[model samples]
Target: MSWSHLLGQRAALDYLRSAQKSGRAPHGYLFYGPAGVGKRTAAVALAQALLCHQPPEPGEACGACKSCRWIAARNGLLTNHPDLIPLLKNPETEKEKVLGDQEQIIPLDTVLDICARLSKSPMAGPKRVVVIPEAHRMCTGQAEAANAFLKTLEEPPPTSVVILTSSRPEALLETIVSRVQPVRFRRLSAEDIRAGLAQGNAKAQEDEIALAAALADGSLGRAKELLEGDLGRWRTAVMKALERAGPQACPGVGLALWALADAEGKRLFEEAEQKDDEPAADGEDEEGAEAEEEAAAKTESGWKRFVFRRLLDLCEVAFRDALVTAAGAGPDQLLQPDGAKLAQALAQRFGDEGCSRMLEALREAHFATRLYVRGDLVGRMLAGRMVSNLRRGP
Candidate 1:
């Protein structure tokens, strides 16, 4: 839409506008921030302003111009706008068909394609804009692609602009990093997320929205997924398993956690499969089909990691609630206010020290998982240690 639509990025927007007004807009920009915090959206908006037939003001798109309309078409895919090139990992090649999954890598061929296109004159406007979403994905242990992209960044076309958006700037090459101006995007506040949810979907219940916002960790994208995925149910099940995790029930608790992971993994796989079954787009051919299959595999594998991470996050929240309750904090202080009673009971049973120990076990399990430990084994160990810790009085 317009710059106004991007929430929690006032500083970034202002900087861009100021640069535009001063005729000092950089040829290359690297927008780095937490995922789903509107980096891509802002990038597209900037492109629109740059390409607008009749921009209302410096750094502001009219949003109603033909160019703006074309940019907005297909949710900023900008396929028909020849002047704007979006060099994202093709949907058929992403680590997951969904966002917030594993890393999606940009292949060398894609980089070469952008280089070829940038060599041409703009078809629809005076300036051409190239956007590379998740630029960190360009690394992928591919020296050719990074080196090729580096050439363009070193001496970009005077009439064209390149914008790279990434959540993991550290993953990018130092050479590439030095060539682009950096625009930092911050995470959204809970209040801002809550407001965004209300604006996006007024029908959502206030309490549900509040819970999602609270658990979102400053990510509106995560908040939306929490609501859509009915994560509340999973959270309830996790809490119940924790409550029943006595020494005798430790195995059962582990099984429950495994079941939860399995169920989520299955659901994600089914979604990916369903997407794969859909008819190919207009120009898609055999190569596209192969790419889709590869992407689906990547998606399935990535979702496994995503599920494990989510379980860890839920565990952390539960233990934090217990810790707060043990400290006699008000119910309002609990992250999961819906589970206040359970948190209070847990605190009474395990005390603060036990909760702390359980949290430590979870952290260790998380670290081990990151270090390539078997997930199921880690879950079992965590379950066993949680039960043991809870039984060992303060």
Candidate 2:
């Protein structure tokens, strides 16, 4: 595949392609971005172009070539190509694994492994490429590995290339960043995400795309995660729970606590982790490293946080709809889907002041959650207060 396949990050592709055509391709490069914006894909395309035996002009890989075939196959399976030595965390323990004394990531052991692979003559290809996903997972102690890799990056290996991908590049050593040319990827657009979902034949609605796009904040991967059946369900349930907890009785109650108590909720939490294909360093064996249970709990909490924020937005929209309806505004101006019924009911029961109070309760709950207050309890209390206030309108 060519670099054009990368959904966004046009400037990055142009720079890499220019380097290739000018025969000034750097030995080491970094592709950094939020997860799932096509950093890995771009790296693979570059690798394929570097190794393609019959490269059609400079910077373009003949996708039909043997080298391209291998790269494509590898991409399909998300495996490291022979020319590319991926710096990855130990899968078994799920933390950075140190191969040698140098605790730096892409430790000497891994770098040496790549060196050995590169030492061999090409098998019908001009160069060997090493692509490291989550390259920042390299341990600081593995500085020796980084140093070793740096030597190769600076000299020798006529046709060898190293590409590093990371969502958290700040975790990487400054030295490493300075040595390699950096390529940054931005989040995909909502339209791009919709096209991708369509291409994948995913079961997503227009509203679903809008919600996911809003929540994803640019990452197509995140948008896809939002489109997942579980997230959609969770979003719906959270919205209902918020509505149930209307202003006053206990306004905005601990809805997430109830939401997370189910088996499906736990399963959804686990699925969220699976979405990130990149693993952490072998920190599993390290002291004070995250425990599985603790990590799982954190993951679940993150899911709750995400769902809760959406609920807050839904509440505001519903309130806005109530206000608009109370003012005898057109349906098109309503924000909530049940705008007609809720608006009429709200106007009859609470009047405008009650609607204002309901908004205040939600705003307070949101602020409390952001301040690290107990989110579930705060949510429940907020819901109760909202419901009570709605019922006992001013």
Candidate 3:
């Protein structure tokens, strides 16, 4: 209901709470952290606390108030509130099937719209809360939009609060960042994650939960996505595919990797097109040419890259599990609790250094594919490197 609802990041919650209590709240606040660890949740909670009529804690929103109810009922902190300006991707319209916040990239038109909305007077509320989630997506062209918002931050509307949230804080302009108080949110613990799942009565295997938590690296949102099924399948599929492609005849490897790459590319494009909601027109025509170019500019490569990244991530988890074993840490300390024996075997075979080398090779292979290199060659090369390095005795 309050910032207390934000799992983990106790220090940040307390700091914001204390500032609210003291009435020393900054006009501009930045919440930066891994996605899905509740940065946006905390921001909204803080916004509600600021706007709440009868906040139990001086700065905390009472969650029971009309204002808080309205905020909570809204789809997103920025989207629903008249005062809250969300720079979220505009959904595809009947006329156009535009992307929705594609891979943390916010559209420029949305950025400008949010800026314009924030520049106006509050329609009904006492205070306006302007939020730009994925602020990093406010690209160079859109960064100009931040300038418009900056003046508001410098001299905010009476009782107005500006909240900026981003997973990639490094992409934000320094001037904009300097004007805000940064609150860092971290990943929730597996226990907290499990507790959250229990609240919803979600039926996910505990082992999968643990694995996703480890892969989340501190983002519960990411953990939730992994638990949703795609990431695990992607990881396992990539490993099996690579294993099959490697140590095969050159022609066979070519056929396998090409088929895999082309199939993945087509699937990604189709998913994107479906999301775009456009008719299946021939891509060679003038109208289709523009669509094709836009589609190409946006990577159909995301699917393959996602698979490769997940594979590399699995390898990293395996290494972390090996480290846990090597350090005499318990199975509970392992990222892959289900793979304890595999972790132990990996530890005996590769030790710490070799495990790192294997990960590096996998990453390099991903990079090579991105550069339009032959995927089969990269896969074979990476497989050879990992096998040579990891198959040796510690």
lDDT against true structure, model 2:
0.62
**Residue range with the least summed lDDT across 10 consecutive positions in model 1:** 285-294
Query: 1-394 in candidate 1: lDDT tens per residue?
Result: 5677687888998899999888888988999887767787788879888888787777878888778887666555545567887553443465222222233677786788777778778887767888787777778689899999999888788888888887779999999989999999988999988887888667777877887788778877777656655466667778888777565776677657766876786787777678769973432221111111122233554555456656777878888899999998988888877778788877876789988998898789768766757678877888777677764534
Q: Which stretches of candidate 2 lie over 4 Å from their true place?
A: 1-4, 78-108, 119-121, 139-142, 249-252, 256-263, 269-394
| Tens-digit lDDT track of model 2 for 1-394 | 4576667677888898999999877878899877767776787788878878899878898889776787665443334444444443443353244332122345455666666665666656777777766677563566676666666666747666778877778977787888888888887786776665555435666666665665555766655545553545655565555445434423324555335433454566787578556674332111111111122234566555544554565566666677778788867666545446756666656667777887787788767766656665776776566566665524
Which candidate would rank higher by lDDT, 1 or 2? 1
Clashing pairs in 3: 49-61, 187-218
lDDT of each: 0.73, 0.62, 0.61
Candidate 3 structure quality by residue, lDDT tens digits, 234-348: 5455444433432233234324444555566567667766866865432111111111112235466654544444455666676667767877888877765666776777666
Highest lDDT model number: 1
Q: Candidate 1, 216: how far from true, in Å? A: 2.1
Deviation (Å) of 202 in candidate 2: 3.3
**Model 2 lDDT at residue 69:** 81
How many clashes in each structure? 0, 58, 2
What are the models' TM-scores?
Answer: 0.85, 0.69, 0.73
